[model samples]
Target: MLLRLLLLICAPLCEPTELFLKPSPSQTIEGNSMTLTCEIQPRLQTSKAQLQFCFFKDNGALKSGWNSSPELRILAMWTKDSGSYWCEAKTAKATTTIRSRRLWIQVQRVPVSDVSLETQPPGGHVTEGKKLVLVCSVAKGTGNITFLWYKGAMGLKLGTKTKHALTAEFEILTARENDTEQYYCAANNGFGLSLSGLVSITVRIPVSRPVLTLRTTGAQAVVGDMVELHCEAQRGSPPVLYQFYLKDVTLGSSWASSTGGASFNLSLTAERSGNYSCEASNGLEAQHSEAVPLIITVPTENRRDLLTSGVIEGLLGILGPTTFVLLFCYCLKRKIGRRSARESLRSTSSPLPQDSTYLNSPTPVPLQPVYGNVNTLSGDDIYSLVYSTQLEQESPAEPPRTLSKDKVSLPIYSKLKKITVIDMDYDDAV
Candidate 1:
């Protein structure tokens, strides 16, 4: 009987007096639901036994009154819902209350959103050998975000950054021409991906000394031939302007919007033979090329042709009129000689009809006095005038009976055949 009484006393102590609170899905998400339950260590004696349960978080009650239900439902937990939580269990007739140990609940946040990419300098331009910085930012996000930077549509990965801050930076020690391209960034917090807009970058390089080349069809450059001036910069940006020069005089200018070389064509002349050069610029420092000498040559065949033509033309111009004048003078002299011969023939053949009788007499006869032209004298012609006078013997007594006069005149001959026939004075008897 004493053993039975001891068992009865231990039986009351064995009844469940502890309250336990358990949560389904111990790890919670921001938009998910969770359930918390309050229970005894063992099963309740009967369903009719009146029991009450209530929930508390961070030492604050979740509800004003306890509920008959053992389970508490928390729908849509947020980041702020993360804290310490516990539950209390009590009987309607008993004055004793049981409490469970405190449990910590943590709710995860959403992924990143509104991601953007920017640069240290406002514009997208960057000079060579200068520093370049890329900044990626998130407008709204929680937790550690992984940021990745990409270049161009081919998605060439530049860099990656993981941090809890709103923004991240990636820097290039020295920018170069190869670094010029389109860039973007992406942010991910293990939930969803966010992409930023593209940012264009251009790296400017100073123009290098250009190379000038002269192109021609033949081996040697000649006058009146077309020559091409090709100017190229091995390293420079586009939109470069190339200028051609001859002895410091500007020939022309060419603009290359997307190429490294520009060309200018010229029809060469003798005066164009000089030192040729070129310059290249892209809105930065300009560079000049070395001067190249160009000498024009004349072909041997062409020179010979020109000389031959010039000599022939000059002879024709000078001697043509002179030959014509000489021929005219010769013809005039021959005509004058023929006229003189005709006049001489007429004078000798035609005319001495009046002297026919005198010509028949053997002795010379004096004719009436006649004057003849002195210009008609020939080698056998005679030209003269003579006078004859006679005196009587009575002249001593009478003082000369008026001296009897007898006058005779003879023709004066330029060439004398004989001189005995002609006398100037005559006596009474001779």
Candidate 2:
């Protein structure tokens, strides 16, 4: 009984020594809470021991100093928080310090969002034979992410990448005409996939010197004949505008939307017979073609034959109508003459009218004098003679009134006198 009492007294003096870190729900996702505890073995019964706890990650202290609480709570966990973690326990006076074994915590991340696709130069436009790059990125995603590049259609995969980064890129060593198409990308983190909007890529090529060709309907180009001017560029973009030049003056322009060239019809004339050239452009620098000389030949014999044939056809068209009209007029005249002869014979045999209405004679009427305004001067002359009716009835008893200076200076002439003198100059006087 004395030995048992001694053992109990010794147990009261003993202190706890083991230390460990315990985490609830070790694996967690982002935006979730987790609790971590610093545990001690052999709970203190009678000893006056005060303990302090601290948390660490990858050997880095989580707090500035030791805390009185033995539990550490993480309000929101993230992928970056995943690492080796350990806890330390000590007394207020630091009489003893104990460290627990390191522990690893894995924090998952949310699904991908805000997926976008961009280009290196930022316009998605690249010149032929140059390098082009396509970049795909996400605003929020973690863990191993898989990026896919597509061209034209979704099923046609251009490339793929799997890495632990937020962004990825695909390169085209040499851009070509076939590379001008729509492109897009997709990002996945083994949880869900997100697709980006379609991006259009344009590959431009500088216009090449065009080749101008002339095609004639006949063996030789002749005056007043239609000739075709064909201009084509061996390598260039579609919707190319081709302009035809005569010597150095612009004739006309033609647009071509396909690989083949454009054509402009020209009517051969004496002035149009000269050096011809063409140019091609598609919103870039224009390219000119070599000048081609042309000479028009005139055929006199062919022209005379054409004129004779045309005159003969015109006569034939009018001959039928003229003959039909002449025949109808002659037949109608003959029928009217026969009817008139019969009517005259019947009238001679019939009795005459006894009424004297046909013997009446008409009376003759006197002519009246005419009064009019006469203009003697020619060639847009404003001066003319104005005859007033008031002067037409003048009393013979009254002498002829003389004209005043103002009356003569004016352009009005109301009285006309008959002169008996034989001087011809007086008749022409104004």
Go through the candidates in order and give each one's C-alpha lDDT. Answer: 0.76, 0.74
The best candidate in terms of lDDT: 1
* Candidate 2 collision pairs: none
TM-score of 2: 0.51
> What does candidate 1 score on TM?
0.43
Clashes of each: 5, 0
Distance from true position, residue 71, model 1, in Å?
A: 32
Please estimate how well model 2 matches the true structure, expressed as its whole-model Cα lDDT. 0.74
Candidate 2, after superposition: displacement of residue 327 in Å?
A: 64
User: TM-score for each prediction?
Assistant: 0.43, 0.51
CA lDDT of 112 in candidate 1?
85
Runs in model 1 with CA error above 4 Å?
Answer: 1-82, 85-110, 120-128, 152-156, 176-182, 198-206, 216-224, 258-260, 269-271, 296-430
| True-structure RMSD, every candidate | 21.2, 22.8
Local accuracy of candidate 1 as per-residue lDDT tens digits, 210-268: 99999987889987799999999998888899999999999999999876599999998
User: What is the per-residue lDDT of model 2 for residues 1-430, given as tens digits with 9 covering 90 to 100?
Assistant: 9999867755533554677888877678776789998877765452434667788999689963587787888887777888998988766664657789998898978788888999876799887888999999999886778999999865589999998778999999899999999999999987877999999999988679999999988988998899999999988877799999998899999898888889999999756788999999988669999999998886788667767887888987989799899999999997897666555444443222121111112432222222222323223222223222112222357554432323322233433232111110111011
Give the Å shift of residue 252 in candidate 1: 1.0
